[model samples]
Target: MNNRWLLPEYIEDVLPEAAWQVEDVRAKLLSLFKSYGYELVIPPHVEYIESLTGIEGDDLNLKTFKLVDQITGRQLGLRADMTPQVARIDAHLLNRMDVTRLCYAGHVVHTLPAGHFSTREPLQVGAEIYGSKNLTADIEIIELMSSALKVAGISEMNVDIGHVGIFRTICELAKASPQIVDQLFTALQTKDLPSIAELTINWEESLKVAVLALPSLFGEAESVLATARLKLPTVPAIQDALETIERVCVHLATIGVRCSVELGELRTGFYHNGLVFTAFAKGWSNPVARGGRYDNIGQQFGRARAATGFSIDLRDILRGLSTPSGKMSILAPDSQEPELRELIAKLRESGEIVRVDISGGSSDELAWDRKIVKSVNGWEVVSK
Candidate 1:
């Protein structure tokens, strides 16, 4: 056998049954988004490196699969995420000054598996709304994600929300050195108190206290907000971030999507400058869906539109779930008669799948629910 027959690690084909389930979920999500006025757009699988992963997306740059374009002799990158592509569309393609809601579903190739249970290739499905920075816009996106989860049959979910502005504000106030900032950020993300204490040890008393206290600021929305208000530096940017979270949480509660506030979280989308969110379904350790506000992401495309959206790994969504059933077929005897062909056509048009039995039929190999039999009244449906 050829050595190439064995595929590389973390990459594999999506077989029929699982592919069907992923497609089913994708269709349901897109349909739901359409009903809410989000239009669909398809971006190329690859593009020039710079346009695909924006400037501040250094983290994403590491995740992207880059290659030299043979035709243009320029470097191109397969998208690891679709957010930048959608932002480009909003900024350049549509060029809409008004608020735009766009949805897309496609395969994205990552240099490595995203996390546990993730493949190098995943079908990413998501929606993005641009040209708005209001907290209501964030709430709407979260609601949309919740609606998709409910449709996917996820009954229980937890939304852990956060804001990067909190850290940004603290950094600005402390005028922290690069080392201290990096250490503090890493500690906060991982909730490593010792690392935080060690990093900020040489810092001034007030700044050190604030940085060290950051990790303990995660919990229920109201309580976290109350504590954060007192513990965090009282800067305008930080206050605005807190207020935005408060309003979004309150609005979500009214819609029954209540979430706990996570002050220390900086989602993998490092460019996220404002509110961020990740959703956990019952029985799953990782988030089923994630997104946040990366307001200036579009400026890389030469337009600054406030953007927020959420994306789900279609493969992840189907994991630990039963494969979706494909269309059931009706067994019919092969015939050239006009009446039989007409009947088959009618059945197919009416949304029934009918498979004609040929000379070498494999009844033992395949199971069909019903068979067509001829009666005085014409073809009749009979139990198999």
Candidate 2:
């Protein structure tokens, strides 16, 4: 027979030590989010296909696992991303006109692994601010992202910042066709200079120069911003985008967080409209967290709200840290004596891990490192 106990590809169980570490990180991050005034919200694991993928576009649609609802005979989808579901809640459920901040933690299933060594199921933890168009809101979200990672013991990280509006403006000015725009977007994402040159070879001279300059317009935020101002067109939109990046960098500097500007980093899907960011820790090829402004996403849900947020995979964070040590537990004899039971309860109440020896087994077979024995005075804990 085939290995009946084997798990599917890219799916594995989180054993005891790692599970405890994940729980500890999750609790700490959620508490940090709460301290910042973001209310917690739990969106369901499955949602109507339209509700889940409607706002995010084809990327999310392709990643989502779909099924038919037996009761309603309508299509349903396991959420590949929770941001859109949270957006739906903000738009339809809350129906609040004022600013709203929401945070969530849960597992999201992907049809395929994101990379060669990635998991299909990730514990996604994130926070989003809706209805605030102010740059301060974005700053606050970034600060929260930094703090959350630091709380998870990842102190040294780099935040790469970019603005989609920069590329959007360049595309509009060039009047590039949909086919050419898509090709150029792919080339830019990989920083493929030759493809960028070939794609823009026939475009207007000024626009061609700006497009070619994009792939090189990354590095220390201040220097990159200055070079972009000089090399890129002086259109209002492009100028505004650069200014926003500069201001965000200045704020980050005050907090001692390092950042770089990448004008060609437009990998986020079509939903993002403005400033975008991704945080990376050393030794990980993929980003630890990513988010951006998607002002028009809520419009698909019949409400237009200015939004920005970031999400990190708790499992990803766990992989970067050392394995957690086993927790020591106290063993209490399974007995009918009221005093023994009271003592066990008191030990547990004092934050001790007490396990009752229900099978009357040796302490070596059990996980407990200590045992309770009746001393002359009363029941007392002793080393096994």
Among these predictions, the greatest TM-score belongs to 2
Cα TM-score of candidate 1: 0.94
Say which candidate scores most in lDDT: 2
TM-score, model 2 to reference = 0.95
Give the Å shift of residue 125 in candidate 1.
0.8
Off by over 4 Å in 2: 359-361, 365-367
lDDT of 2 by residue, 261-342 (tens): 9998887666788999989899777788888898967887899889999998889878878986878899888897999999
Candidate 1: tens digits of C-alpha lDDT, residues 36-138: 9999999999999998776563668888999999999999999999999999999988999899999999999998887887789988999989999877788
Return the lDDT, model 1, position 322.
74
TM values, all candidates: 0.94, 0.95
Question: Lowest summed-lDDT stretch of 10 residues in model 2?
Answer: 359-368
